[model samples]
Target: MLGIQNLSLFIASGLLLNVIPGPDSLLIMARSATQGWRAGSAAALGVGAGTMMHVLAAAAGLSALLATSAAAFAIVKWVGAAYIVYVGIALLRSKPGKAAAPAALPPQPYRRIFLQGFLTNVLNPKVAIFFLAFVPQFISADAPSKPLALVVLGCVFNFNGMLWCHALAVFTAFASQRMRLKPRVTAWLSRLTGGLFIGLGLKLALSKPN
Candidate 1:
């Protein structure tokens, strides 16, 4: 178990990190704004699940390979960037319908949304590298159960992330209800989201390994 001092500090740092808007937050907001609460919630869960994979990989020392190998990092980074750009393009191409039509329009399959969210997090090498660097700060090299400690810490981080994401989903969903009534406004929002995604993809693509 983590000592009280470490646990408290980790929680505080995690919350602060989660509050700062990032690609994950943008994805959740976009999904909620465009597709409503269900899609957004699915996205949040997907992101958490993907993050768990990185946490486990970090615990198992797999992320070290990624961190050390330029080829590995580039491959994952490009794939992630491409995928994000693809999604952005798809969003841009979508025809705007009446705001009132969303209710009548069938909801996107939860599985599809979930997968989109999952892939979004999993493909980002930045996330893998983040875990590789961030999780160990709280761990002691002398700890008897280092892997267990990392897992526990990762769980706490993911739990905190889930709460923040869910809250974002709910708030956006509420705002979207009114926004959806305005076709022009909805169209513009979609365009803005699409543009943001493309920008994120470009930024990710251009990032250098630390």
Candidate 2:
């Protein structure tokens, strides 16, 4: 069983981490800005699903393998970076007019958005490494069931992440409505998001294992 003090600390740490915008958050915001709340929500749910997979992997000690193996880490890192860059390119190529005219553009299937979100996190080795490192800190070595404790803690973290992501989607969706009226603004937003995705991809590619 988790102690109250440990649980409290974990919750605080999780919230603090979630508040700092990362690749997942950026993706959600970009989707919300371009598509709508539905797409953003799908993306957030996808990320949550992916994170849960990491939690399961961590419980099974697979994430630890990723953390320790250079080849495995590199492969996942490159794949993730490539995928992000691909998404950025797709965004850059997207028609600005379509973005400005939400009603005119065909609605994107939520399943596709969800899959993109899932792949983005699942392929990112850094996320796996993060789980491997972060979750164990709050787990007592002498705990009755370490794996169960990890799952519980991971659920708490993921719940916090979902709440934050959904809030971001709602806010971005609201702002997008106003921004969509200005053709120029909508165009610029797409370009900015595309650039952000590309930059994040490059950063991920260049990152060294800690």
Candidate 3:
């Protein structure tokens, strides 16, 4: 079992990572601001799925391959990047006057939005790399049962990531209300969100692994 000191650090680190405005944060914010809370929540779920993938990969010795193989890393990275860009294009092309807000989408059995959110994270190889880089800080390479330690660390990270997603879903929902009445503003925000995702994907494509 993970110790208290490590648990505190794990939580703290997760909180910090969650707050950081990476692809996951931007993706969630973009969808939420553009569509409605449901859509945003859907996107949040997508991001959560992505985080879960990372945690599982880290636990299953996938992170070792991520750390060791450039080709594999690049493959996942580009694929993730392409997926983000693809999503962005779809958002940009979205029927401006159509589509309920992200909030509305979530409560009405909106499996499509949920799946969109889920796929976004699942395709991102960067999440795996991030876990490979991040989880090790607290892990002892020399510690007994390195694989088990990695798994525990991965679980902690996943939990923290979920907590962050929950917070975003709630906090952004409040702001989303103000956004809903103004259709013009909402549409513009959606466009911006789409652009953000595309930009992130482009950057990810170009980034060299550290």
Candidate 4:
């Protein structure tokens, strides 16, 4: 059906990949821990939206350009790295009130959080390359429409990823509630996450095109 092959294997592989810790998962978890589940869901949805862009790009064969063109790849990579670093710095600079309740801690506009998640996924040229390389395996050669096949495969992967991301958000929020972390402790967690983001951003910046 739809020129798809080994779909079970593809879905299994996608699930495993989604479980691996990455910027997408980290952003969702961080938002859930600091804000509530709703905020986490916003981030998760934003990520899903970003995945749709990649899916469309893949269907249009734009990803192939990113995979082959050094200049295009470098431009996107630097922009993505810079954005991630900027977000991390903002988190590091944020200071929550010592007495603020978990609910009372300053709330970032959910729209901004959503945009953060969207850019986090969409701006990474590596993601486009990964889709170009990975999504094709399950699509049969000589498919009726190669572009349609790519879209189907990309949508499946994104759906599975969204499920995992939302689950992570819920779980993180639940665990944080259980622990009842103090405001000071939450602040420290935020800072730690910020540092991790910085490290991840630098790593991405330094990454060689593959």
Candidate 5:
């Protein structure tokens, strides 16, 4: 309606993409499993908020700078990678309590969890690039306002993403509860997720601008 074309295709593609595992999904799942649905929801909301930033940046043509400027891209990439690795290390270092599974790792405040998810999503330069590359494809060249069209499409994408993210968080939490995970197992999960994060960070660090 907003001079957008192939909107159905865009929605379908966005939903599929949201299902794929990544840092965002990992964060939601980990938080849900370790803490509860509330923590996971906080993470999901944070990620959604970050997506809006990319949408705004894409509409303003700021994302183009990351696409074209090597210096800008590299600086952001390094910083993001470092942050991801740091979070991973923190998870790895978390100690499990001898008495209780819930005590394996202390519950993080919702605000902190939200901020973590937000930073993780927003700091990734690739997300900005993706918005620039992907969203514009559906915008008509002769649209009333290309920037406005981008914003509308970006909102649609983010809305669908939030649905999937929140679903993932709730489901993961439910399953973890059902399993009645032991303290040692909970600690193991934390370490495993931590290792995965470290791997992802290294991969991001070595990534070349696409």
Candidate 6:
């Protein structure tokens, strides 16, 4: 168990970020609504996977390396940015039509869905570097269990991320049902999401390193 203070802060941060709409959350909503639970969950898994990568990199000291080294940071940033842009384009080309619903869609291969989740997280350099930077501030710089504490912090982040995204996926699933009756809205929303992803990628690509 985390120290009371750490747990409290972790929950607070998670809840705050969870509520704020972002690319990952939006992607889950868009995919889940259109592709049903499986697809939405696939996106959710992606986010979680991305989270794991950040935590792992932080644990492995990659984040710290990137932090002090400008070239390394830029490399991560560009790679991550490009990946997001690629996903956004793929989504745009993917049919906006409701191909399946929770009830109507065939059971998605859970293993693959889970793997997709892992990959999504793994490919996101922003999340990776962000986690690298974010965790240390909360930990005591001189703590004996700094590495252990970081691992715990990463776990907290992953759990919170998954829980929040899953909740959104459920919400989006219902919303998708309602939207099936309104194809125009779905189409417009899909375009908006695609645009958002691309914009975010571009912004991230150009953003100065911390």
Which candidate ranks first by TM-score, i.e. highest? 5
| lDDT string, candidate 6, 93-173, tens digits | 654344342222223466655554555456556666677776777777566677778888888878887888888888888
Better of 2 and 6 by TM-score: 2
Tens digits of per-residue lDDT for model 1, 111-130: 88888889889999898888
Across residues 1-210, which tens digit of lDDT does each residue of candidate 5 receive? 778999999999999989989889988988999899999999999999999999999999989999999999999899999988988898899887575456455789999999999998998898999999999999998899999999999999999999999999999999989998877888889889889989989998998778
User: Any idea what lDDT model 4 has?
Assistant: 0.86
Best by lDDT: 5
Kindly give the number of clashing pairs for every candidate. 0, 0, 13, 0, 0, 4
Q: lDDT for model 1, on a 0 to 1 scale?
A: 0.82
Question: With candidate 2 superimposed using the best TM-score fit, by how many Å does residue 76's alpha carbon deviate from the native?
Answer: 0.6
Model 2 weakest lDDT span, ten residues long: 98-107
Candidate 1 vs 4: which has more TM-score:
4
Pitting candidate 1 against candidate 3, the one with the higher TM-score is 1
Error of 2 at 169 (Å): 0.5
Q: For model 3, how does the per-residue alpha-carbon lDDT over 1-210 read when each residue is reduced to its tens digit?
A: 432236677778788877888667766666555455666677777677767777778778786796688988788888889988997786666544534433312232446666766777777776777777777777764667656776777767766776777677667766877645455555566667778889989998997767
Residue 193 Cα positional deviation in candidate 3, in Å, after optimal superposition? 0.9
The better candidate by lDDT, 1 or 5, is: 5
lDDT of each: 0.82, 0.82, 0.70, 0.86, 0.91, 0.69
Residue 18 in model 4: shift from native, Å?
0.7
Give the clashing pairs for model 5.
Answer: none
Candidate number with the higher TM-score (3 or 6): 3
How well does each candidate superpose onto the true structure, as a TM-score? 0.92, 0.92, 0.83, 0.96, 0.97, 0.82
Clashing residue pairs in candidate 4 are none
lDDT of 6 at 30: 67
